[model samples]
Target: MVLALGGLAVLALWGLDAVRIQPNRIVSGTGHGLIEALGTGPALLVMLPLALVMALAWRPTRGREALMLMLVTAMLAAMPWALSLFIGQFIDDPGGAARAAVSGASWLVGFALILMLIDLRQRLQPGALVTLVLIAVSLGSLGVAFGRGALDSLALVQEYEVRRAAFAEAIVNHLILVGVAVGASLVLALGLALWMRRVAGVRQGVLGVLSFIQTIPSLALFGLLLAPLAWLASRFPLLSDLGIQGIGWAPALLALVGYSLLPMTRNTFIALDGVDPDVIEAARGMGLAPLQVFFQVRLPLALPLLIEGIRITTVQAIGLAAVAALIGAGGLGTFIFQGLGQAAMNLVMLGALPIVLMAMLVDALLKALADAARRGDADDRTG
Candidate 1:
């Protein structure tokens, strides 16, 4: 799959600078969007290999293989478009516009590849479904390119290049924020939870504080952090000099971390509290120290719940991160806020589409991980 995708990207690079071929119409060419320029080439390349791999991996279950292939193809096709959308957010130029179009085309290819690989039932034939979608997209692209004056009134759409840059910026920043914030939150939550379970007063106080933080509106929480953060920023000249542009990303991240704490803490407490007391006493009677008992006995029993808390927190963080745009912390939120401010529905949709998709994807992935953990636990017990 990786090889195929790399080949596709290379193929695209080969023609990256070539003038696009367009069918003549009133408009003379497709109005440049991220999908039109760069997506198709890369998507096809990426999806082909992934679909093949999935088919091989699940060959015994044709239905599953088919489904997986179809999904992989769709994802590959969507990549170019997604890349363009993100890139559009930061730059405005014909070159950038072309790149954005290429991205959309790539995503389309991914979609097609997924469809092809998956063996689908008549009722769930994603291949047919995507084919129809591709047709519509192709027609739409053509209409915009060649329909002449039909779309003249829509000419004021932001330059694809600028939109693409913005899109790229939002994606990179959001991914980084989520990765770091979630990882840190997991660690902190785990540690805090352990302490609370062992020390009753500590658990109550920490939960109370986190719950309070959760109730505070995210935007408000960011505002509340501004003064102290700024003061600290000023006191540490090096931090200020680190070229950290604004309080936006940091504060937004802090807010998310704070919000995530509650789930982790609560889940940890519940998991630990629910543990059979006899188990702990047994471990102790075996000459285990307090640390050993918690780590060797309690932690193993509590792993499922602790993981569940992480999953919940991670999903919650994804949703809340959108609000970070209010503070100039760019993400999908930028598009949403920009559209709202300008009353542009398309822009709003453009921004919101990814956030919704990303949240769903992340949630599904995490849920799968948690379920696997639980299954492993069950297997151990049975064994």
Candidate 2:
């Protein structure tokens, strides 16, 4: 599998268009293969690490995963610079309307390397230190290249340069929407889950309603929310002054939290309910009070699944919050919708790239937490 991915990267790099040099931003521009973009010497240099990785895959060693990691990390770190090199060599007017956009070959090759990295890490199950190092190396190298203006001539970077402030604001708003939604949903779901437990009659009804909410299309849900919010704002002067309008964050947040509840409630209820009754009996055998047994015995065992639910809900919310931009809830998706309206692909990427990174980050962190919790549970059982 690893070797196949490496071959795909090689084919993409050697045969396909590495960049598109647009006369202006809107045009897709002319294709330039790897050799045309970076010259034969540098092109061969780019393949050298790939070759080394293929060789390592055939032989296999414990330490070689680390070496292969370094190779792929170098390839990814060099990706932005690779585009920078393309611009330096191919663009005739660097300071004018001319800009270079990354094309199919660049994206495919980069994605292939990222897949390779993920595959290696999953197989090795490296410790947190290794994981942190991976992040620092990947993001640090890319961030340095971007910060130094190495990619200034690239269309994506050019778009970012134009919207630097708005980009920052969008990122903050995106996170805020997801954060508040997850937090609110967590509290509500916990209450609902506990209530359903105490009142057995409502179990099916509660689950059914939550499932029904999930079935609603996001855009349709947003539309449905518009009127009630507008009525509320009209009925209450304070709500109107506070930005609780028909088409802004008021409806967006309500919709987000509504969508977030099912997973949170279901997982939380199952986690708590699934605890071994035998263990609870044993805790009572120790003469502990009911509340003490619940806290000291049940909650700890349930924590991993609780985190698993949060992880799922948070990742799901991140994507939904992007859609919130449609309702004037400003976020990274603002750039996406704007770019689509204006036919500016690079601008769309400016919004999309950050959102993808944010989702990946949340998924990884929460997954790590769940793993650690599971390991601790194992330790408790053994000790």
Candidate 3:
């Protein structure tokens, strides 16, 4: 209740002028607040009812789940009008065309609202939360598609529109880089881990080398790969034909692969090594061959941890691939660097938001998979 009241107070006191308006490149312009979002009279009428509902919902007798649902609904309802008002402020610009863009306050409020929703979801049944999320996403998409929202006018949206083709291409390139690097790393790490397990004497040395590789900064690793890759391309016409080069995807993939090795190798080693000796013995006594024991028993037991390692490496690779743009490897980082060079904050956001969303979604999915694996393991034990 206190937190809800505090949030309300902040919203009322600071208002929700989350967007800044600039008229014809004017040196200064005014900001419109959510308090006056639908004009004074309408805003007052809307806010009073919403506030009353919230207050009523906060009472001890009212269900917390209902309160959370109501609050989220109210916030979503207000979003379109609030955004429209912000965009409307620039519509009648007398001087010339005007541009409206998100401000720092808007970003803060947006993130805070998202966090609040997530917190509320945590309190609800998982099935309920999933339903709510899907509903919200559907409604939000419909709103955007119907042009019922003002997001289209935002500078970030404009940047996306302008470079839509490039954005699509960048998405493809980013996936390719991450896919190839992770695939290669997984294969190599698995082989190395198996070999080291057989030859215990060299395990420490191999891990130490991978650990050293992990310690190197990503940019430095890319730089290190450049010379050898360049030499390989120069000396071998076949390598050049295969798209091997000092810069671009070659070094980017190599660097990403190198960074992935430590986590992948470590996880595989731990998972395989940690398998129960009793389980192994039972499999052998059942007349299972060495390879069969490994494939059917050890591998199945270790699968969850292996998947977890891939999840970690995949998330890491997605983010790092953005940095690969520095060496002419086209990805979302292209927009980020270009935005920085041009001093366009919205452009930077256009590049960044997708990467953030992708990472979050991937992390969530992998976590669910890991949890399922654990549950399955528990069930096996019980049986």
Worst 10 residues of 3 by lDDT: 22-31
Instruction: Write down the TM-score for model 1.
Output: 0.58
**lDDT per residue, candidate 3, 113-167, as tens digits?**
5555565555554584676664576456536733743566666666777788999
Candidate with top TM-score is 2
Q: For each candidate, what is the lDDT? A: 0.62, 0.90, 0.75
lDDT of 2 by residue, 1-383 (tens): 67999999989989999888888888878889987766889898878889899989887777987788888888788878767866788766566789988888989998999999999888788888987898788888889988887877889989988888999999999999999999999999889988988999999999999999999999999999999999999999999999999989989999999999999999999998999999999999999999999789998999999999999999999999889999999999899999999999999999899899899999999999999999999999999
Candidate 2: list runs displaced more than 4 Å.
37-42, 55-67, 92-95, 123-126, 285-287, 380-383
Query: How much is 69 displaced in model 2, in angstroms?
Result: 3.5
The CA-based lDDT of model 2 is what? 0.90
Candidate 2 pairs with clashing backbones: none
Model 2, residue 12: what's the lDDT?
Answer: 92
Full ranking by lDDT = 2, 3, 1
Give the CA lDDT, 0 to 100, for residue 34 in model 1: 31
> Can you write out model 1's per-residue Cα lDDT over 1-383, one digit (the tens) per residue?
43344345435433433222122111223334333445877635533655455445443355654555445444444543444343444334522222212233333444444444332433345555675665455446435443432222221233222377878888888877777788888888778877886687886689889999899998899888777778877888886786343476777888888888888778877887888899899999999999999888888888777777877887788778888888877777888898788765446766777788788778777777777877987897799
TM-score of each: 0.58, 0.91, 0.86
Clash tally for model 3:
0
